[model samples]
Target: EAGVAQSPRYKIIEKRQSVAFWCNPISGHATLYWYQQILGQGPKLLIQFQNNGVVDDSQLPKDRFSAERLKGVDSTLKIQPAKLEDSAVYLCASSLEGGYGYTFGSGTRLTVV
Candidate 1:
């Protein structure tokens, strides 16, 4: 089966700039998640969606971040007026069940320059 896919691999932007990342989950997978991983720290769940409906987005920084999954396939996350502290690896993952280990994309590593 194909794994989750993410784009850009890396990104560099100044504080307050806007950036966007894309993700494509495996076929047949019904759950998708976006996480922010800072260096040396664990991945923190930012948003989760079951199909095209939001399941959990409590951790997402709504002030500057937004995401959506249309048609229950590909998803996109966007950040506007990004902060220096927001620079981190944006990882996309999919799992059959929330209890199972997720398959992660290489991630979009964002660096605030």
Candidate 2:
């Protein structure tokens, strides 16, 4: 199976700066998710999409974080005016709808100085 693809595996930005991460999920997968993993902490669900429609975003910080899956394929996540606490790895994952297995991308690491 082709793995999910993410770009710019690492990033560093001063506080209040903005950054964006891109993700391309495996083909045929209908569900996609974005997660935030703080250092030494388990990944937290940021958002989830079924096709082009959002299934869940209750954990997303809409004030500064936003995401979209374009036409139900590739996706992007953006964080504006990043805070020091936002430093972490942003991961993208995808799976078949209602499937148990999830394939995850390598992730983009953000450091807010």
Candidate 3:
């Protein structure tokens, strides 16, 4: 089966600019997640969505970050007025259940200049 898909594998943005990342999960998977990974650090869950509704977003920086899963399939994550500190790899993952059998994308590497 195909794994999760993510676009623009790499991105370069200026500080204060906005960027959006898209994701398409494996067929039939019901749980999706967005994670941020800084170099040398483990990926941190930014948000989790079950179908079209959000399940967890406790670590998301609500003021500048946002995400949505549409129709229980595709999802998008956006960061507006991005800061230099936001330069990191953004990962998209999907699972059949909340915390098991996760399939992650190659990741979108954002370089804030």
lDDT of each: 0.93, 0.94, 0.96
Write candidate 1's Cα lDDT for 1-113 as tens digits.
88899998999999989999999998877899999999999999999999899999999989999999989989999999999999899999998876478889999999987
Q: What's the TM-score of each model vs. the native?
A: 0.96, 0.97, 0.98
Off by over 4 Å in 1: none
Structural RMSD, model 2: 0.8
Best by lDDT: 3
Give candidate 3 misplaced runs (Cα > 4 Å). none
Shift in Å, residue 65, candidate 1: 0.4
Model 3 scores a C-alpha lDDT of 0.96
| lDDT by residue for model 2 (1-113), tens | 79999987999999999999999999999999999999999999999999999999999999999999979999999999899999999999999964469899999999999
Worst 10 residues of 3 by lDDT: 66-75
Clashes of each: 0, 0, 0
Those runs of model 2 whose alpha carbons end farther than 4 Å from true positions after fitting are: none
lDDT ranking, high to low: 3, 2, 1
Number of clashes in model 3?
0
What value of lDDT does candidate 2 attain over all alpha carbons? 0.94
TM-score of 1: 0.96
